[model samples]
Target: MTAMLEMRGVSKSFTGVQALRDVNFTVRAGEIHALVGENGAGKSTLMKVLSGVYPHGSYEGAIIFEGEERRFRDINDSEALGIIIIHQELALIPLLSIAENIFLSHPPARLGIIDRDAVYRQTRELLAQVGLREHPDTLITDLGVGKQQLVEIAKALSKRVRLLILDEPTASLNEADSAALLDRLLAFREQGIASILISHKLNEVARVADRITVLRDGRTVDSIDCGAQPVEEDRIIRSMVNRDLAHRFPERHARIGSPVLEVRNWSVYHPLHPERQVIKNVDFQVRRGEVVGIAGLMGAGRTEFAMSLFGRAWGRNITGRIALEGCEVELSSVPAAIDAGLAYVTEDRKQLGVILADDVRKNITLASLAQVAPRWVIDDVAELRAASDYRTRMRIRCSDVYQETGQLSGGNQQKVVLSKWLMTDPQVLILDEPTRGIDVGAKYEIYCIINELAEAGKGVVVISSEMPELLGICDRICVMNDGAFVGEFASGDATQEKIMRAIMHNKRTSNGARESDMPMEGVRP
Candidate 1:
């Protein structure tokens, strides 16, 4: 079959740095071609070049689309040729309605006057095609991250996109939603639409992609057909890293000790609905030198539970009794939680965890500024010393501590967040989706760090959607359902099946019960 898109001898440079080197890639019509690489492997740069972000004169490359040589000067030029690139970070207006967002740049108009009804009708049809049940009149802000992603796809479809490029589309979605999105991609393929999927989820790539291309150091390492030969994940990893990866999850010794943190009958109400409690009465405890994992499906209130405990970060009506080292403490705000030896690492690192514009040194010292400063003025030397210590400890790879956090890879940025919290010297640390977007190599390093924390006698609570990840590192697993703790099992006793069963069992029981008897919804993942 003739290639739908092709690039030959492509090369790109940025500020004295060679981002791409003699790269070659191709995409066939009506197929899913996956692009896999570690962060900063020039995947985004190459995509930008293809989509005209770099323009023709700015790079050394030849782009051939549909048997015609094309030199795209801008994003609009690429879009006009039926090519659209959806960035890693979504670009949707939160306050706008779904119809308005879908037809933002090019609205349905009659005689240069906006036709609101036509826009809604067209948007509704597009949403249905994407298998989204959301109303076109619904505000985008009220929708969850997963629904917002569907809207993005609907918007692309509006432009009659032929080559769709998705960058980390499922990074924030739950398992069910992620599966639904993948199904839609397959549907699109059946309709003769070509897709260039960029993702770190090797399993998903293996399942959906017809061809896989591995890139390393801005160069094409290899491309293989997933259907012709059963491609092992390690083969792809080896191509990307050029090394044998012995283990994806590092080994850890569980040294569980005395109870360090305890929560009894914890409950929190929904922020918008006072009568609707998000976290039901729940009881759990974490021992020193132990890592506890929370497992659940999306909307199970795992994040809500963790945030409520961290200085009431999420819930409005909070009712909980927390004890640290056998002493009761009141944590009403974030500052109070930090003061009480508690630290929270949020899932959305770019949005909630790190200040991207700030340097690594500054972000590391942000949490515990008082430790580096004797008086009101911040001591630059002290701050640098503290950051340097963490940089060494966490094995963060960067040009220097002075480099902006935004420039670092996803894994390295997560390390900076961990370093920031570690500087606070918290007794209990909560890590929410700690390894969501990082690669296996970086995940191993993070696992080592978690083990180190437990070895130091700190209590750790981990919330993750990946059951394998929870099973690998956690000493014990706690299952949550509908904002309530339904079951708990030791690492040796817990399995993915059991945890899922527990969640389902609890959900069924709660649904059968009265509305008044329903538990609050703030159960940690």
Candidate 2:
């Protein structure tokens, strides 16, 4: 069988980084080829070269598709040849309707006027192809992340996309949604549409990929063909991280201490829909030298609860009683919350975590500019020192403290987000999906950092979709559902089944955290 696409002698470099080097990749017709690699291994960079984001003459490579060599000067040039790339961060406009977004660039028209009926009529067909039941007129913001992903596919189909590129499509989706997306990819393969999938989720790759290509440090490591033979998950992990990852989490010698922060009868309403209550009457607390994790589904109010408590950054009709060291405090704004010794790390890191264009030194000192600046003027020396210290301590693999956060890898970008919040010197830290896009190796490092923070007598609150992560690092795991806390389990007593059962039953099982259950560190699923 003739190959659908091929790349020969591909190499790309940035100012001081060689992101890709003489990489060779191939995909067959009607095949779902997965590109797997650790963060910063040149996976995205290679895709950029293919999709024309890097453009012709920018990288030394040959991209052959449909048995013809081509040079794509921009994304539009590549799209003209039926190649569409959907990035991890969705490009859909929240305010626009689904049909409008689907054909925003080009729509059916006569006399230079768009045909609304024609647009909706064609949109319905595309939506049905992707199994999205929503009406074409529905707003993109009204849909969940999973549905939005399907909408993206629908948009691609509208363009007659022959070769589709999905970058970490399921990284933010839940299990059921991820399965549905994979099923769609399989369906597309049967219909003769080739796909290049990039993801950190090894299980999905094993299940869906016909062939897997591994890239390590800007070079192709190996290619595994599932049709020829099955590949082990551990082997794939070893190839990506280049080490025996015997454990995904680090050791934990926890010493549970006194209560550091508490909240009582917390309630918040939706900012846009005033009548809709987002967070119901909720009571939560975290103790000194303790890591408390909140477990829940996507819309289970985990993030809303965290953001509402953090200076009401999320909701409108917010009503809550918060206390620090057993004393009630007012947190009406973000600055006030920081002043009250509270820091919240948001789940949507790319949008809300740090300024991507800014350098590491600036982002680190942004949250604590007052400390670095003795007067109202400036202090570059102190700021650079603090940022450099964090860069070394956090193991942020960058050229230097002056390196832009945007140019770094996902794991390093996450570390910079942590550095900014840590510089605030808060007694209580709330981390939302701290390691969402991070790889397994980097995840263990982050777990170790959390343990270190707890050992320093700081209260930590973690919100993650991964159950094993919560069970591994949290002293107590709290099951949240429908804007309320239903149950709590100490580290020892907490299991995936038990915690899921708590969510299913929708009832509180324990009164508070207990240190006697088990240690969360070094435990595997």
Candidate 3:
């Protein structure tokens, strides 16, 4: 394979913070090259420089494409040269049809008028190429996260993309969706389309990558060619973190106590559709000083149940009995829940978890303003002191607490959200996908935080798609399927196979079908 893209001596800085430092990256003509790194290790920054998002002359680098040096003034210039970047956040408009989004910038036009027929026809071909069966007329909102990802790829294909860049493409996808997306990449490789995949999921990287590049602290650490030699995950992890991580998860000794949080006959109806019940009658309990895990596939209502339990932030016609230390509490609103010693860290940190535009100090103190306020007047000194304390404690890598939350990395932003909730001094903390897009090093830090919370005699409920994570950290695991608790297991007895089996069993019972009739491949990671 020939060199498709080469970034030589790439260096980028922002406001005196060096984001990239002499980083070197290369991708072959028809290979899937993986770019793996810790958050803030400059992977995204380097890609932004290459894709012209940072533009020419702003970053120190020489971009060589197809044996020729190229200077791109903007993304359009790079796109014209067959470069397309799909960010982690899907850029498609939800209201628009798939066909429209695929050709939003460059539609099939006949004399300044969009040719709908041609657009739809081309979209169908692109979708087919990506193995998406949805019609071109289907709205992007109507599709699942996995299908939306495929549409993004099809859109890139529409632009004649020769070098495709995907950042955390499978971060929000289920196991089946992730597998399908990986298959699409393989198909593209066969067609001689090169791809640069930036992901924190090392398993997927090892599975599909032709070459793996490790970036650490804004510099290229090592590049491994899979065809030359088989690389173990331990080697990649050590290279990325610059240390031997003997265990992926930190060891925790559970000091189980009495129940801290209890829920009985909890149920929730869909907010949009009143007739549909999203959370069935469920009974759950988390003991003080214990870390409980909720394991389920996507759309299994894990998030729905968590959101509903935390002050009814989601769902309609919610019915539940929540108890704190054996005392029943009425949590009708967010404030009531907070007052009743309940805090929730949302899964979608960018959207619902934190105010990105605000500074870290503001975000950290947002949930518990009373702590920093005296007589309803916020004391700036006290607020700063409080924020500074949490920032240091959480190990949030930023210039200062005054820095904008949006400017921080994913792991740091998540810490800010956690800091905000911790400020409330809640007895029960519910975390949803706490380590979704972070690197292994950062994930270890988050797990340590969860253990710290549990050690403080707080009931911690963790809901995650990653089964391995739940198995590693939780004292007890609860399996949820189709809005109900299907099975429960202690950490000693829990296995991925057993949890998956419980899910299949529930499907068999609920759908009134044979066990063999249900497919479990899609749900298992």
Candidate 4:
């Protein structure tokens, strides 16, 4: 079979920074090509070149598609040729209906007026193809992340996509959703649609990809043919990061202490829907030198409980009794929460955690600006010194502290978030999906940091969707179902089966609880 697409001698640079070296890549007709790399490894950049995000003259390369050389001046040029790219950060107008988003660029129209019936009729067929059962008139914001992802694909299909590129498509999706999406890709292959999948989930890639391309620091390292032999995940990791990963999670020695932070009868109502209780009345505690993991299905109220406790970021009419070091404290707002020696690392890092446009130095000092300022006067020297120290200590891969956080890879971006919260010097830290979408090596490093945080006598609470991750790192696991904690297990007693059983048991007994998993996109592969 002849190749459908070929990139020859592709090299791109930005202001003296070489983002991609001389690279060669090829995708055959009707094949699922998996691209693997650490964050900032040039996978996205190469895709940008293909999709015309960087345009034709921005880089030096020859893009031969379907037996012809092509120079796409812009995204429209690429889209006109049946090439469409779906971004991980979903781009959808929340207020608009599903059909509208699907046919946003080019809708069926007569005399420059949209034909509504044609839009709905065609959207229904596209949605069915993607296995999404939502009505065409349903608002995009009403759907979960998983469904939104499908809508993006359906939108791509609407454009008559030939070469589909997905960047970190399943980074935020749960195992089931991720599996379904991969299966959809296979189905698309049956129709002769070639897919270029970029993801950090090695298991998913290994399961679905016909060919695997590894990129490291702007260079093509290897292109393994799965048809010839199964690709080992460790081998892929070694090529992507230039080192053999000895472990996914670091070993830890526990030194349990007395309860450092305690919460009693905590309750919170939905911010908008006052009648709806988001967090049920609950009692929770975190001991000094302890890493406690909250394990639950998506929308099981884990994040709601954490965010509510962190100065009621997620809910209103909150009622809670929080005691730190045996003294009850009132945290009515975010500033008060911070003043009370509490820090929360949010799950929605792109939106709530990091200011993407800001340089690393400013972001590092954002949470605790008082330290870098005295008497309301700015101190640039102290801030720079502190940020520089953290960049080095966290091993944040960047050109310098002056570089924008958005320019860093996912792993490095996560490290910067961690650095920001650590700078606050809080007594208790709450980390929500701390290692989500990062590479295996980066995950291990984050695990080590968590362990070190516990060792330093700072109480830690971790909320994660991955059962194995919670089991691997936490001293104890608390299972939350619906809006409350249903079960608790010591690290020795905790198992994925037991945790899941707790959830199942809760669902069976409570009338108000979700009988099935909540339709929220979560978990990391």
Best by TM-score: 3
Q: Would you list the C-alpha lDDT of every candidate in the order shown?
A: 0.90, 0.90, 0.92, 0.89
**Candidate 1 versus the native: TM-score?**
0.94
Residue 266 of model 3: what lDDT? 89
Locate the minimum summed-lDDT window of 10 residues in model 3: 516-525
Runs in model 2 with CA error above 4 Å?
511-525
Q: Where in model 3 is the C-alpha error above 4 Å?
A: 507-525
Write down the TM-score of every candidate: 0.94, 0.95, 0.96, 0.94
**Residue pairs of candidate 2 with colliding backbone atoms:** 472-520, 492-517, 492-518
Error of 1 at 241 (Å): 2.6
lDDT of 3 by residue, 150-219 (tens): 9999999999999999999999999999999999999899999999999999999999999999999999
State the weakest 10-residue window (summed lDDT) of model 1: 516-525
Candidate 1 off by > 4 Å: 507-525
Clashes of 4: 0
> RMSD of each candidate?
4.4, 4.7, 5.8, 5.7
Q: Which ten residues in a row have the lowest lDDT in candidate 4?
A: 515-524
Clashes of each: 11, 3, 0, 0
Model 3: pairs clashing at backbone N, Cα or C within 3 Å: none
